[model samples]
Target: MRITVGKWFQGGSPWVWLNAGAVAISLVMVVGLLALIAVRGLGHFWPSAIVAADYRVPGQESRQVLGQLADSETVSGERLRGAGLPLDPSLDVVERSLIKVGNRDVTGSDFAWVVEPWLQDAHYPENVMAVERREWGNFYGYLKAVREADKTVATGDQAWEVFQQRIARALAIHDQIYQIEKHDIGSINARLERLRLKERGLELKGNATPAVLAGIQAERAALDAEYKVLEQQLGKLYVAFNRDSAVAETADGQEVILSMGKVVRAYQPNAMGLVDKLAFYGDKLWEFVSDDPREANTEGGIFPAIFGTVMMVILMSIIVTPFGVIAAVYLREYAGQGFMTRSIRIAVNNLAGVPSIVYGVFGLGFFVYFLGGQMDQLFFPAALPAPTFGTPGLMWAAITLALLTLPVVIVATEEGLSRIPRSVREGSLALGATKAETLWRVVLPMASPAMMTGLILAVARAAGEVAPLMLVGVVKLAPSLPLDGNYPFLHLDQKFMHLGFHIYDVGFQSPNVEAARPLVYATALLLVIVIAVLNLSAVAIRNSLREKYKTLEV
Candidate 1:
């Protein structure tokens, strides 16, 4: 089957095959990574259990019958049975008795054995049993029931009535407590305000009369005493809220049932149960999306890292875009061809290749220590002892990333400026446009797509960066947001958390690694999505601009 072929295709084909192989390998690597991430991240949301039950059925049966029923005497049709009197045609006798089934460890009991009359028609008959033999099913349900029953026996309407009455009484007590505390605080504040006013009056009169001064001093002392009492009372209320007795109420006006201890115990089993495990992870994922910045880690949600990451990226973009574009414009269009310009171009390219960690160190030294120190010495002598600019903060992090990604923007923008046809510039100059005017209107609009592309790359790089930000501004945990109620509220000097740092911290540095693994994967997925969205948006803008200017022939 040999056939003649062209000389070019007949020999030295190994290089072509090698190039194809390399491309295939790269595609496999990228696709494999995406597949792995998608599987692990999405698997967390899938249901992992067969059955779930809370064991708090409102209409639970109080009685349970065990053992088989006794046989009944049967009637014969006009015939006598051996060793007995003649059987009647219509007479019949049955034996029945009530019995109690003792509680047992039915972990291995069959589904049929644990079935009660009410549970026979359950959707998942195997899962709805009161006592599960298998450890795989929702064991936590049974445990919760056991714990809840120990705390309270009433069920259904009876339980609801008891709960309502208790809540009402607790509310009444809380209202009384709040009113008393408010009145005491108000009185103390009023007295303090009056004392301050009197002192001002004395100053205005230019007469520090002994009686007036004494009156002011006495009022101040009284206000302090009252405030102390109010604080003490408030402390007591806080203690009460923490204690079980605060929510406890007597069913018969004689015996109080304390629920705080019981409720906490009951919650433990439910938390350990399979259904609760699913719910817990679900909530964790939800928290990653919906959490507000005000919540702490202990409160089940927080979004400070998300907010800080966005703010830092925006600040970096603002600082880098203009500087990079201008530098690119100067290098590509204005700068004459010379050894000096060529050398500078090489240096700028090399800067982009430098390790980000090194940039972080440079930023810490130059921006934080040198520039910040100079500013502090020149402008803030009264606040001299405290360091402001020298501290690691949001501003420093942004500036550091801006520098790190500057070369990328510069290279991209320069390529864009180079792409515009030479005739366009000649025509602008022919029309009496100056160099600045050409750059501003004609050159910039044409080069915008390239600039946007550079900005997109810079943003993508800066957003995922963890190591540099860690050294410069990112904190493991930030107590307050960078923007707050303080004077000149947007405090760039304040340290902030980032999602990338959070991923690193929770994955490697967490106290409970096993418990935090899912959270780590979820956070990593979120970071990827955020970066992808930012890049996609920039790409869209670039495309839109390209389409708008498509009709303008080069």
Candidate 2:
């Protein structure tokens, strides 16, 4: 048996099996992790039933609790007693539930923990509504009435219908207001700023004449006229939207009037059938991916973060590929394989192992501070003190990440170039092709797939990096996207949001921990999906290239 095992090891069969097992284990773990995240995160958007129950804690007042049951657990009775809660000596364990009692404006918190023994008369009422708001997370209450500027337009069950109709109107009006303010007014602001820069440029050149000044003034007047018209339209819409309100009664019988404009969506989760809940889930998921974040990023969506992440990765790929390829070509194709070349390779390998935060620090000092400051002084002297390019923004961030992942690309490209047969290069050179021409057509085409492999790895790393981005550019909330309906639409100097940083901020930095936890899981899963999709795209391109050039290999 020992001889047989030794022979197996010598044949490399055992090692192959061991390596396959390791890869299998890794694949299983990755799938399991993604499954866990999807279950925890995607489940959050499904409309859960709201329960109204009576609770009586020992030596405390008998009161009503109304909320969604968020979680449940069984704990030792001794722990409860140790925490100063009165408990029976005979009871070894007790069950408790965490309920999402979301009337934060009134209760000061969005969640409550209620012991099962003290809870009674639990019921799911069809009229119970879950209100997603703009300011205070979520509101759970019974719709009592719907009003139009003090006059009750809907009462009891009828109010529910009225509420939905008017809220839809309010949302439409709000969208219009958003477009005008962000798109139209935003354009005017950009034009005005450009005019200021132009004036400053002319002044610097000693050419600030009266006629030139008059032209700038005339353009300003035209923009202001448009702004006034949009402003007046916005004011009227605001009045129209604010005219409607709803009076909702809490479980404690306290009635409060809420504006329709503040509510994002209202749904009766308990009353919704499986089909209804599924539809609601789909809509919520779409909104989460398609809309901008609101309420300190704890409430609405993360479309901006998604857009910023993809945009940054593309920009990084574009900036890094050429530089990395050129470096690799020089080292592998032209330079002699001597001690210096070996030392440079060792340095690049060491760079890959350096901590990511070190790259962030370097980017801040070198890219944002040094190079940007010089560019600002030379080209944008007119916009001084404000620090245009001298600030953390999109272009600097892309360049910083390019530098951070440069080693990976260089290594991959070098490997690919090394794999190409030397005889192929000789054959091309002997057939009337110069060395440069042979490299550009024969070698490069065959090696294009390897360059893509490097890009795939670089993109996978860059998309998930949050540290370097924090210093170079990612923000918690970017009011405007880097690209918009403005001049030079792709504004490389604008600050942007990132999905990885969004996850970090919501998961750790948020003030509302319990409320943010679900979002954290959801955002994390989304980030993973985004990276996977990006990798798959690059992989597809690489596969196509490899297939096309397969005949050249033999």
Candidate 3:
């Protein structure tokens, strides 16, 4: 029981405690970061009570303001005075707040900073309404009246009900118009482009006969007729789109008319109960994930980005797995333990440490420019000069990521192979099985869990990569997904949106900083969740494989 300090140090208890302490610290930091992101991001969906206040700054007239309180900070009085604000000499610190006054079209600003002491008569009015628009950010005001064209349809207390009904009608019409334009007309446009390509392709090969030309012309004419019908329907829908308008009185008491067709939704946060707020929050959260982005990606859903991120990761996994496994097998089972093989293994390990951006540059140069350009010239000469495959797209992005993650897979697979008892392989060969047969049936199956582990690591790394994707395929906004209902459904040559890239664009490239900030947090959280789900799925498969082959290992 009387152990000396030197004896205790020799026992290694301190090192064990040190390692556990380090792990605990790391876990706390990770959990704390995720908690912060969830709070800041998910809190954006909950409706906050809009405050109406009379604010007056030094050397300015007092004006009525209506908006949500976004954030607050304490600053030195000296700093405030340096910014030309008059403050008491005795004051050491002052509190300032950022308000999201969302009449961007009228006031020409999305937010305004006010000194807390100068804010007078701050209150939440039940009559105040927050309108989510398809354009111009958000509109905060009081409902004045509902009008159909120049005629007043409803006024006073009934205008809110009438406005809601008209908004529902407008949204329904919008959905119909969206279907016609994006789906039906989009399909026709794609077909027409293909026909043009076909004609050009024939001309290049000196095979454009009169009958062939006439057939192409006939197809074009049929598409034109269909387009014309959709065009007429769209013309009528446009007329309906702007049919109803709502008159609203702003915080400044100026009346502005907003088309019901342009309104996404309207809410009175001051009047909403907990249940109503929860419903509103759910709707907003769904829209953030399912709807198309609007207002320069500061508003709307990131469904396209989500689709592209998942699609590219799946493709990368498919490309990297087999190649990694083969290379690992060759090195571990067949290749001699020579200097050249040792050099190669060292090189492979070094490659994993190389900066990811360098891989992106290599991918852009080799995969996109060299190989894709050659393919375009040799196999798709018709699409030449336009550079179909030669451009940055989905295929190149996937290949680039696959190349980036190959080292991880090879190392993991090799380790797994090294773990398989040599006696097992010897037994398989002794039991009337050839070397190839032993590898195919016994070795590979037992080694599968390792391949899955490699794949899981690859997915974890590839899904979060933004720089390489930016150079190869990721775009700010993709008009349509790489996948569609067209022939040869998955178009790997198309550029696509990505969640990581979207977060970058919205967080840094957006003009509306305040509006984009919360969205950045929310999108980042979603990206983490996506990577987690992918890794967890891979992990589940890996565990299952391990269980199935556990007896083989014994």
Candidate 4:
């Protein structure tokens, strides 16, 4: 039996199969892309053996090089020769490997591409040290000796054991220093600034009388005394932190002295067993997520970015939901079904199609320049020269995103409201319920699932948006989170970090492209996971709402 194409289309089987094929292809592509990103990004944290090899290219000197093999690729000789490199005419293809030669101060670059044909006698040495740093990225070399100032503490075979011990002590001290500076002293500094602002405000109000001044002075004195104690402790810590230095020799045999506090952690990747390597990898991954970024944000963790992203999304959701729901209820329940209402609905639908960057521009001009400026002029007169709300910060970012996604919420809610049977509303009215009561009690409950759906879509769109955030509140590095332990714990006026902006900054604005590429993928993967989590939470709520209202709707 020959099945004609028209007959198959008429039977709807062709359309069903066609849709299934499209969905399958989409899933495969999305999964494949995510897998690729995961492999490239997550694999960067894993410990790889550092290869020490003598590399020579034709007439070049045979100098030894040491680095982790970063990547490999095949290149046609024609392409190589086009770039002014001499290659054999007979060579059709040549394999090359990129080695992450990580002594940046010594080599001036973290990576170097070496032709595979020119490398010889490659081996992994157990004694080679890979030192993760607080400043210079990573240092890969052989530890020559352990020293304190000019005095050599340990050398020869004893250097490794002694180096390990002193490094552990140095790291412990570094942690203490970090805690005091960032948390303890940081809190003090914040309080001191608040006190200064308070004094300024009092003086402006003509209330800085002698007694008030005296009381403020007394408080300042107490804070100063406390600061001095913290300062002395910090001074002692710095002395301890910088006292221990290790002498390491690069593959080129030049000795480099690295201060102990500068080193984050050091290990011999080449000598680690599978279990040890896995442990190290786990530790590094945790640090990446939990630690604050250092070294121009190419290294370390992204906790600040994560926190800011989630906070902004939540704030946006809070601001948008009520406004959207109210508008939708009025339009669907109370508004006359006339030309004017239809026009307003069309305008709202059109808003969903507006470019995101346009919203960013509108936010910057209206919210930041106009509204924020007025706020600073009115409420923050003492802080005139330095703008308070008259700057891009968390609140404005949230508000801007709320406005951008309002249309989506309104449309979803209206559709949900329309889906509720007129009979239900009539029944409520017939039961002597007021119109407001029907909307509040009966109408909204059925439409709650649709509101959740809108929120999920809104979050998915807003979470990944970078352009608007860049203009409003997103920054490469935020010194403090929007919410903190300070009074008015949720500091809505503070500028914030964001994962989407971090991806953009790392991928494009970073000084080192090759080094930042993996970070980009990792950050991208993190963003996808965050959006998924948010959507799943909304979905769970939506499912529960649907279940609860199922009988009511029927």
> Model 3 compared with the native: what TM-score?
0.99
- Native-vs-model 3 lDDT? 0.94
TM-score of each: 0.62, 0.98, 0.99, 0.97
Error of 4 at 21 (Å): 0.5
Q: Which tens-of-lDDT digit does each residue in 1-554 have in candidate 3?
A: 45787788899989999999999999999999999999999999999999999998667899998999898999999998898888777889989999999989999999999899889999999989999999898999999999998999999989888988999999999999999988999999999989988999999999999999999999999999999999999999999899899999999899999999889999999999999999999999999999999999999999999999999999999999999999999999999989989998999999999898998999999999999999999988887799989999999999999999999999999999999999999999999999999999998999999999999999999999998888999999999999999866899999999999999999999999899999999999999999999999999999999999988762
lDDT per residue for candidate 1 within 257-285, as digits (tens), equals 33322121112222246777667557646
Model 3: clashing residue pairs? none
Q: How close is candidate 1 to the true structure, as a TM-score?
A: 0.62
Runs in model 2 deviating more than 4 A are none
CA RMSD per model (angstroms): 16.4, 1.2, 1.1, 1.4
Error of 2 at 23 (Å): 2.1
Ranking the candidates on TM-score from highest down gives 3, 2, 4, 1
**Which candidate should be chosen as best, given lDDT against the real structure?**
3
Tell how far residue 340 is off in model 2, in angstroms: 1.7
Candidate 4 lDDT over residue span 138-233, tens digit each: 899999989998899999889988888888999899889988888788888888887788888888999989998898888888888888999999
Write down the lDDT that model 1 would get: 0.63
Q: After superposition, how far is residue 229 of candidate 2 from its true place, in Å?
A: 1.0
